[model samples]
Each structure stands twice: as structure tokens, then as C-alpha cells.
Target: MNDEDHYCENCDMDLYGISPIYVDYMDLPYCSIDCLAERNTYKKYKTIEEANREAEKNRYRKEEK
Candidate 1:
């Protein structure tokens, strides 16, 4: 397990000591499959092509308040 507090790219939960699930675009690491699914849902996309088409939009949508 990585000692660094690598948080879930989706929910931003601390992902210490847990295995990470990485995506391809930015190689972002997620905490779990559920978190990965939630992220895709948040992007309102089921395919990488669609997500890439509006990557900026998804990025803006997931920005921290």
C-alpha cells in the first residue's frame, strides 16, 4: 500500500493503504470500482470517446468548491 494519501479521483476520499484503480485518460487513480463507476456517472458518460469529447466540461463539473 502506498503511504501517500492518494485520494480517489472521483469522490476525493483518502485512499491510503487500499489498492487503486486507474483510468487511462489522465491515469487518475480511484479508490474502488464503485468510485470509478460514480465518476463515469458524474461525467454523464459511458464511453471514453464521449467523455473525451467534453473533457473540459467534466473537469469543470468535478472541480472542488
Candidate 2:
């Protein structure tokens, strides 16, 4: 298997790969179904609806930070 095929050696997961591209917990990498599920909390939602909602929130939070 290739680097992409396996979990991110650095992160030890394989959730984000191929097609839409999986981005977990603030852009963390994953390797297997189990690994992906393990990061339910950190997983950055990939859906357009989710992104839009977070983007809107970020717009407001940016000023605070």
C-alpha cells in the first residue's frame, strides 16, 4: 500500500482520501474506518452545508480573535 492508502503515519488515521477528500478535526489525516470514527469530535465536516455554517461563524469569530 501507498502512503495515502494507509493512515497518515503522523496522525495515525485514514478518513480523508479520494473524491471529495476527507478532512478530519481541523485538517487531520486518517487511514481506516475505525480511525475516522475515532475522531468524530475533531472531524471537520466536509458537507457544503457544514462548511457554510462554519464559515459564517468564522466570519464573526475572526473579529473576536
Candidate 3:
């Protein structure tokens, strides 16, 4: 997606200029780890590292399939 399309799913904030933009397991963008956690109530992630670990696991599983 282009810069115009990069926005946080939770707050709808522009993510184009933001460095280290957070993304969920589903590849949805967020302005911060807090916003990522807020949007994904089903998953409990205390930090970005936790979220990234889960995402990496899921990615491997998908690739294996």
C-alpha cells in the first residue's frame, strides 16, 4: 500500500510518517503497541515483542501449510 493507505486501524491515524509502526498478527496497522492491543481484544499481548512472537509463529504455520 502507498503512504496514503497506511493508517492505524484502531485510531485511524496517519502512519505514513511514523517510524516503527505496529502491525498485528493479521497484518493490520496500528499507531502503537497499545493501539494494537486495544483493537485485538481476543488476543492478550502486553508488548510489541509478544505480538511479534505470535505473528512469527502464525507466519511459520501458514508457510508450512
Candidate 4:
């Protein structure tokens, strides 16, 4: 693997010897779901706080249903 492929694009976790690397829609790699979610949220909302707030609202709406 090249230098760029050796680490996750989101968390920079070493991908060497790690099986089943996670790839995003944009072809970005991640070590795990948490890292993927974090990067995706930030990419869409532009801030973690805003993404969290939206999640909370969605949770509340689900509870109400």
C-alpha cells in the first residue's frame, strides 16, 4: 500500500493489516463507523455541534411517534 492508503482519511488510524477498511461515498477511507459518521456529519452540517443538535431533534421526533 502507498503512504496515502496506509491511514484512514477521517481519523488517520493506521490501516496496515486492518481487514475490511471502510470506504465512504467520496472514496475516503475510515477505520470504523464512528469515524465515518463523524466525518460525514461534519461534511454535511459543517459542525459537530450542529450535527448533534439535528440528531437530538431526530431522536425526539422518533420518540414522539
What lDDT does the true structure give each of the candidates? 0.76, 0.54, 0.72, 0.77
Output the lDDT of residue 48, model 2. Answer: 50
Candidate 1, residues 1-65, lDDT tens digits: the string is 34444888778888776778988676688988988877876678767667677877778888954
Q: List the residue pairs that clash in candidate 4.
A: none
Error at 56, model 2, angstroms: 0.6
Residue 34, model 4: lDDT of: 83
- TM-scores, in order shown? 0.53, 0.28, 0.47, 0.67
User: What lDDT does candidate 4 reach at residue 42?
Assistant: 81
Q: For model 4, what is the alpha-carbon lDDT of residue 38? A: 80
Q: By lDDT, highest first, what's the ranking?
A: 4, 1, 3, 2
Task: List, residue by residue over 10-52, the lDDT tens digit for candidate 2.
Answer: 3554534442224655544555455555455345676657767
Clash totals in order: 0, 9, 0, 0
TM match of model 1 to true structure: 0.53
* Local accuracy of candidate 3 as per-residue lDDT tens digits, 1-65: 55545888788888876753546455566788877667675357877677789899999999998
Candidate 2 to native Cα RMSD, angstroms: 9.4
Clashes of 4: 0
**Alpha-carbon deviation at 12 in model 2, angstroms:** 27
Superior candidate under TM-score, 2 versus 3: 3
Q: What CA RMSD would candidate 4 show?
A: 2.4
Q: Candidate 4: where are CA atoms >4 Å away?
A: 1-4, 24-27
RMSD of each: 11.5, 9.4, 8.7, 2.4
